[model samples]
Target: MGDRRLAIEAWESLFRAQHEVFGKLSGDFVGSDLSQAEYDVLLTVTRAPDMTARLRDVTANMLISQPSVSRLVDRMVGRGLVTKCSDPDDGRGALVTATEEGAHAFRVIGAAHGRSIAEHMACFDDEELRTLLTLTEKLRGYRSGE
Candidate 1:
């Protein structure tokens, strides 16, 4: 029990330290204005092929709820960061696309995000990162009902 407690405490300390460093770095690089969710939507739209994605597709790809995604899209469209169109195949389904301004904004934000991720990873050796990813994926593959 004593050893278990000690190990848990150590793990927590390391986790907090990493979080603090990453939070500060990502927050700075992402700027003070854009919320993380907003930036996520923007970047996802920008990086999508043809700068377009079906509304439900974005929600599924982002692992967010449909209503939440819709609200986010509404906000973004209001800001002129995206354009909404009816999906040609399904009129009921809307397509969200990045506007020119949004694409340009993404370019700026994307560069910053790239640099931030690169800087954070600079401390890790390739093997360490690869091992971390492998373990994470292994643990994440549980069946949905499990």
Candidate 2:
């Protein structure tokens, strides 16, 4: 078993670092055409095949609730950021596709956001980054031995 005090200290350090980095990175959205959450949505949608993805899939990547995501998508549809249509594969599901304008916006914001992320993470070298990635993935059950 792990040492409880050491585990708690590690968790606190990780949480605080994430919070600070995220706070700094959130500035990338200020005065931009897209908000941070919208960028997150596009981050998932833009990577999908043909820039289209199931609404459920997008929601899976988001930290919000399904209803909240649905509402956000509706808002994006109104802004010409994306289009929503019924999913052929799932009767109850919807599909979201990034518009030309939306894709362009995502690329613009994504570039700067990428830079900001790199700047914030610059304190860690490549090997340390790899370790951080491995540990975080493990925490999320992603790197668990299959």
Using TM-score as the measure, the top candidate is 2
lDDT of each: 0.78, 0.94
The alpha-carbon lDDT assigned to residue 36 of candidate 2 equals 90
TM-score, one value per model: 0.71, 0.97
In TM-score terms, candidate 1 sits at 0.71
Weakest lDDT window of 10 consecutive positions for candidate 2: 137-146
lDDT of 1 by residue, 84-103 (tens): 88999997999899988777
Clashes of 1: 0
- Where in model 1 is the C-alpha error above 4 Å? 1-22, 29-33, 142-146
Give me the displacement of residue 13 in model 1, in angstroms: 9.2
